[model samples]
Target chain A: MSLINIFSDYTLRTVALGSALLGAISGVIGTYTVLRKQSLVGDAVSHAALPGIGIAFLLTGSKNIEWLLLGAFISGWLSLYIVNSIIKNSKVKYDSALGMILSVFFGLGLVILTYIQKIPDSNQAGLEGFLFGQASTLLKRDVIVMSIVGGAIIIIIALLWKEFKLLSFDPEFCQVSGFPKEKLDLILTTLIVIAIVTGLQTVGVVLMSDMIIAPAVSARQWTDKLSVMVILSSIFGGLSGVIGTIISSSTRNLPTGPVIVVIISAISIISLFIAPGRGIIWRRMRDKKNKKRLNRNIILNSIYNLNIEGNRIQGYSLEDLSISKGDFNFPINTIEKELEKLETLDLVKGKDEKWYITEKGINEIEDFRGRLEE
Target chain B: MNVQIEIQLIAIVVALACSTLGVFLILRKMAMMADAIGHTILFGIVVAFFITHDLNSPLLIIGAALTGTLTVFLVESINKTKLVSEDSSIGLIFPLLFSIGVILISLYAGDVHLDTDAVLLGEIAFAPFNRFVVNGVDIGPSSLYIMGAILIMNIVYVSVFYKELKISTFDPNLAMALGISPGIMHYSLMTLVSLTAVGAFDAVGAILVVAFMVGPPTAAYLLTDDLKDMIFLSGIIGTISVVLGYWTARIFDVAIAGMMAVMVGAIFLLIFLFAPDRGLLSIMRRKKRQKYDFAQISFLMHVINHEGAKDEREELGINTIHEHLGWNKEFVKDIFNNLYKSNLVYIEDDIIRITDKGRDLAISNAEEIVNGI
Candidate 1:
């Protein structure tokens, strides 16, 4: 398949559109989840939704995405509620609750699915698509349903932006200011559930969390403001959706969810390393530069002290500096390099093998000491 | 032994192995790490398999366990950078690794015996068919022996280092002060988790291993305060789930591992709701009882404080006392009635007076409150 085929092909277009919409919705909701440190809650909810899907199929005897998703939404919401209750009611830790609920619900789901498999009906064939997601099987109608639901979620988020922002950043203040913190939390959690449910067809249960987490994490590296972060995260998510779709479609034996996960992970890693201000690479580079400047100053200050101690203006060898430095493990080569750098700054002048501190170097030391005292 | 008995034995051993270590994982708040390791170890097995080209090689278990510890190291490193929170760090690392594992399995589906379904939902029913043989003499199923050995290993490890593990888990700083390296204990525990996960994977699959590990221990945590009791109770819970889950699956003709997981959840829900002291129902009941007790104590203290004072008539009048206490009239009346029935306070000439017993109780309660106990 070629690039143009992605648009011209009907199935590919619907799949791409569905994946992109799913990505954008999850990305927007993910910003709040990640900021609130509820990232793994998405993981638990997605896994917990599996049993609901299986039960829905069992009860309805049909594979209608709507009914299945409704079931998914209920159970996913229920799982989050139970998790919250566990934390509030017992000594069980958050991670333990999350892991236990996630696995047990998923286990129940497998039981239902297997029971369905023994039902002797071929309709159960495609139901397993929810496990790893069959993005290629997404129909036009499914995309339309996703769009309408996704549009409603986006609207709700816009209307509740202030409350949601306050809830995410400072729930105590949100409570103190007369907002119903519990109700707001329920609404936020519901929205997160809907986002995970919408993307389940494309990303599946096992890997759906990356859809909610990676985009926000990547976008977070690029900006500090919530609005920009939200927009950037959605864009990263939507772009990965399209790109992953095209790549997966063009290849053989590639699942769209994992491929997209790999791509977004790449983006997150890149952002972590190269983004300005918070980027690891930039921080490391800045630290290196600061250390170099500090080393240069230390060498300059030492030469000034040696001159004052000798009570004479004289050149000194590298050995003299090393002797004065005592047990400080500044390597001999590093000291030599600092002296050469000082000579270039005109802070020191070296003739033959001995180095002498210039007047500028002496004044620099005095100024540093004056600033320190002040 | 028959196939049914063999499968149940394998599951029982797997559950025991998981729940033994699960107590520490939950206590240390690293239960999700078990979930992460459960998934990421698949990547380790795949890499090791690709190298050894043998499914039963000991190197696979070693490699997978190493990968599990590596997952912890990576998550902690990302957490150290403070670029992402710990939960997101976990959420990020495992999927990427698991996805790679899945993609690899799919890409080489012909060469590898592993399938994505088996990775997520294992086929434990087939365990009996893979019989272990030595010198042409058939022993029990290979997984039965494998899981049995792992269970013994876990028991030995926990019993030998029970003190160290207990101290380190409850208070890492104290453990450090006592010259026990929390880091070593953590890594060693993670290594065992990985080993147990790999062994259990052949029986319960990657995902359900988390159920076996977290569900029983968490439910047991609700039922017991003692660490030793919690560990023992979780193992018992795991055993019950395995036996019941096996029979339930047999009757319903469904997946055994999945039913076992469901059983674990069901048992947990029961304990969560109905455990004697720490359960939700009891906690709510305690809260209600404490509310009335606190209100009655405050009422008695008020009467004692105003006894024979100049404002006693004005302050201790039942109708106006509600106003002073800022409580609803009906609630105040209810508390007053209860206090009068208990002989703690009596109304005479419309002024409430505290009895000697009530005065003693009120003074001691006030002292306790003042002492911050």
Candidate 2:
């Protein structure tokens, strides 16, 4: 489909809208989850929800999205509760608890799914979609349900913004200030569970975590403030959702969830490399420039020091400068190149193959020393 | 052997291999790295498959090990940059690689023998049929042998490097000071984890391999403090889960690997709730007993301090003593009765008094508390 056809196509529109809603909600909640250093919780919760979906189908014997997701929400929350209890009560570490619960819960889900397949007249055709999500199968009603849930989550986040912020940054301070830390934590966790469940239909179990973590991580590279990070993260998430849905829908045999994951991963990688301030490439460039400037200053200062030692306005050959002085070693070509650049800056004067420090060069050396002393 | 026995053997071997290394993983706090490696190795297998065009090629194992090490390298490098936290780095890298693998499978490998469902939810029921043929005779299930070799390899690795792994896990700086490189230990262990994961993947799928790797060890951690006991206990737990899960899956006609993972979780839950020293119930019971003992000590100390005071009558009166101690009347009465039964305190002229035993205990406790011991 072309760009305009994406909006004009009914199935594409529904999938895109549902995916965007899922992405935005997860993005907003993921900011807090990532900030709280619980990024992998989404992975565990999503995996755990698989069993819930199967159990829900078994009990209700229908493919109602609402019932299925409610089942997902409950079980996902239960897994998180179990993980926290295990961490708090035993010698088991957090990652072990997460990995254990995630895999075991998913195993149970698979068992239930296989059992469902065995049942006569079960109509289990669509259940496998939860494994590797089938966004192309999303209908109008699913999008409606997603929006309603997504809207409520956004509103809840807005109402509890201050509490969530305090809880994320400093739970101890929030608790000391008479806030119910446990209850607030439960609320935040529940909100996160809801977000993950809502996105499960779009992204599935295995890749749902990237939806939660990638956008927030990308947005974090661009900004330090919580609000900006949250907003930028949601925008990045929503755009990836729409773009991924479009790409997957246009292609043959491309699963929407993984494609969406690929898009978000690309965005995260690009943000890591190119975002200002914290970007890796920018930091590297800045470091390189600083090193170059430092080298130039060292060469200038050395010329001034050699002239002072000789107690005469004498020039030094490139050979003299290339020799290691006080552990400062530079290649002969590097020394020559730096001298030429310094001469252009009027800091040094080069005649033939020899170099002499100018009056400005001496003043610059004195200024650098004075600054260093202060 | 029968298919049932062969399948169970494969599972048992897979579990043993995973749980043994899992002990080190949890100790080094890299259990989730196992989860990451489990997923990303699929990308490696897919790439290796494309090169060899054969599913049974040994090069796949090398590719998986390399990919697992690469995942660790990338995560650490990203973490070293301080751009993202460690968890986020893990969450970021694996899914991307796994997605590429999934997409590749869907696109080009569609007609191949590779199945995504088999990769994610391995059908161990079919594992027994993949016989390892030697000359003209069959030598049991191929996965059983593969997993058996991997299990022995894990046992040998752990035993050979026990001291190094222990020192590095508990104290990396000390390991470094002792001239053992923790980085080498870390990457080698990661390589081993990937190897075990790939070997187990055919029998238990990608995600359930994590259950095998993490579940038993976590349960064993609750049962013991010694590393040797932990390793032994986790292996035992893994074996029990494999046997029980196989039988249960047979009875219900369900997915065997899934049932095995569930069994692992259930065993871990049981140990978490009922283990002798570290169980939740025992910990709570210990806290309750400590509370009562602390209360009794405070009661004895209070009576001893006021035994010969100017306001002894006002402070030591039975009705007033509860008020002086800032405790409710009923709780104070219960504490006094318990202390009286223990012969630590006595009632004289309706005033509380401390016996010599109580006085001695109170002085020692006070000194210990004041000394911050």
Q: Candidate 1: lDDT over CA atoms?
A: 0.90
Model 1 docking tier (incorrect/acceptable/medium/high): high
Q: How accurate locally, in lDDT, is each candidate?
A: 0.90, 0.90
The fnat scores of all predictions, in order, read 0.89, 0.92
Residue range B157-217, candidate 2, lDDT tens digits: 9999999999999999999999999999999999999998887777889889999999999
Q: Which residue ranges in model 1 land beyond 4 Å of their true spot?
A: A120-122, A307-317, A325-333, A352-354, A366-374, B51-54, B305-334
Report the TM-score of candidate 2, chain A only.
Answer: 0.94
- For model 1, the chain A TM-score is 0.91
Proportion of the native interface contacts kept in model 1: 0.89
Interface RMSDs of the predictions, in order, are 0.8, 0.6
Q: Estimate, for each residue in B1-373, the C-alpha lDDT of model 1 and write its tens digit.
A: 8888889889999999999999999999999999999989888888887888865567787887788999999999989999999999999899899888888887898877778887677889987888889999998898888788889999999999999999999999999999999999999999999999988887899899999999999999998889999999999999999999999999999999999999999999999999898889999999999888888889888887777888887899867998888899999999988877888888899888888888998889888888986
TM-score, chain B, predicted structure 2: 0.95
